[model samples]
Target: MIENTSSVNRVAVAILIAACLFMLVPLAVAFVTATLDYPTFLRGGVTIIPGTHFFDNVIEVWQLTRLPRQIFNSFVTALGISLGKMFLAFTTAYALVFFRSRYTIFIYAAVLATIMLPLELMIVTLYQVTANIAEPVNWIANIGGLWARYFGDPLGLKLSLLDTYPGIILPQIATGGAILIMVQFMRTLPRDLARAATMDGASPLRFMFDVVLPLSKGPLIALTLFFFVDGWGKFMWPLIAASSPDMITGVVGLTRLDFGEEAAIPNYPLKMTGAFMVSIVPLVIIAVFQRRIVRGLTYMDR
Candidate 1:
């Protein structure tokens, strides 16, 4: 028995070491790629050497690719999606928890059903609906005559919400994952608490705002952080939705470098630098919120 236990422990240690390496290798590669020079990177394709051109590559990406604007767009779109997701999830979960009826079951079933459906299947319909929704410009057009000024010189400045902010924000909001998470979480909350709140003259809204939301902080924060990271990392949708390269987010900017039209030759160093610049904030946020996320996941339904 003693010998068997010792062997098991050794195996577990080996597995842990392998897992750690698997996780770190990609990050190490990306960092090395980001740090190397063009000549060095070209010679060592798919491999990286430690050297000094890190800052130069980063600056080149920023100047050539309009990385700042991409980051900004990413932030804006992520904020909108996360906010919409939070509200929808909270409300859906609340309803499912409080009102267990056929309709509720149907809604939950529908959401679960969507989980099996591939997102690629929905692209055509989504695109059509997106194109049909001509984004409302009342906010911009009304305030400062900005709309006319922006489009007056159409040669240089391209304007429209077709592949713009609204195009990105709205589509993300109509999803069901957030609602499903909220519903699952709300089920864990004691029914007695909601009932007590109701007995104490609290409306459903008050119960949710004052009672449920506070209890849900763990999951909510986790979801927000996830959405933020996902938004920053988003590439395909933004590439399709954004009309101009300038309006595209940093995630898409990385791919654009690969299809080098001129003498750019798909600079790996610059691509990695762009990726790092775009990805660092979301990574930092995940690291900072790592404890909270774990706590939220560990929470029991009791």
Candidate 2:
């Protein structure tokens, strides 16, 4: 057994306390700054002294910004993205793990190769595709002027996914990291379970639903929460994809908060308040599922 010395314990406790303080201090400052009114904020400029206008500022932000609607949009987008990623990852990992084929390694390699091509790198091409999903079909139809010869014009078919939920969620769902994690986790399972399920006349789908899926609850929950937070924090893609103000997300909406005219002093206090408000949902989710998150990540039953 490892020795548990008092001095070592004290040092660990001190480090934990320091880490907590490091994280909380900024939050405290933001809260304090958010509580101050415009005049008080202008004069004091981000003080630790708490003011009494927290509710007043909240009301002002609610009225002045489209944050409420954007928050709802964020919820829908994030939830859809999370579920989509989880389903794709789970099914892909399942096939990679359970299906024995000559090309399995090649397929896994191809899937993992996509991690190199992030959304940012190919965003322009993605936007083009999202703008008109049937572009490929149009190209094929107009190849060698085949369509123009018959119809007297090139094939022009437009099926846009822009400004829609599918456009935002579908493109973001192909997560290689989640698939990798699920594959590694599934590899750790007892091989005899699969053999026994086969002997008991259980089909692959039945075994997946009744056996593997049930045991994978921990990892699934962990991945869902992780993806949800990721989807929620996405700014650039959502900003570009969503043309209308009604479809903007919380993060984008937070940035859109007007800090007054170019000549006037920027309203830092109100902006901080909006930041804090936007952060609430994710913070609450992490706090509520703290233990489960730890357990799932570590793959520990305890």
Compared with the true structure, all predictions reach lDDT values of 0.75, 0.89
Query: Against the true structure, whose TM-score is highest?
Result: 2
Least accurate 10 contiguous residues by lDDT in model 2: 259-268
Worst 10 residues of 1 by lDDT: 152-161
Which predicted model would earn the best lDDT? 2
In Å, residue 77's CA in model 1 sits off its true spot by 1.7
Q: How displaced is residue 156 in candidate 1, in Å?
A: 29
lDDT of 2 by residue, 1-302 (tens): 97869998899999999999999999999999899988887787888789998888888889988888888889999999999998998999999999869999999999999999899998999999999999999999999999999999999999999989899888899978889988998999998989999999999999999999988899899889978988999988999899687888889988888856473678878888898888889999889987887787777734
Clashing pairs for predicted structure model 2, backbone only: none
Candidate 1 lDDT over residue span 93-119, tens digit each = 788889788687877888768766645
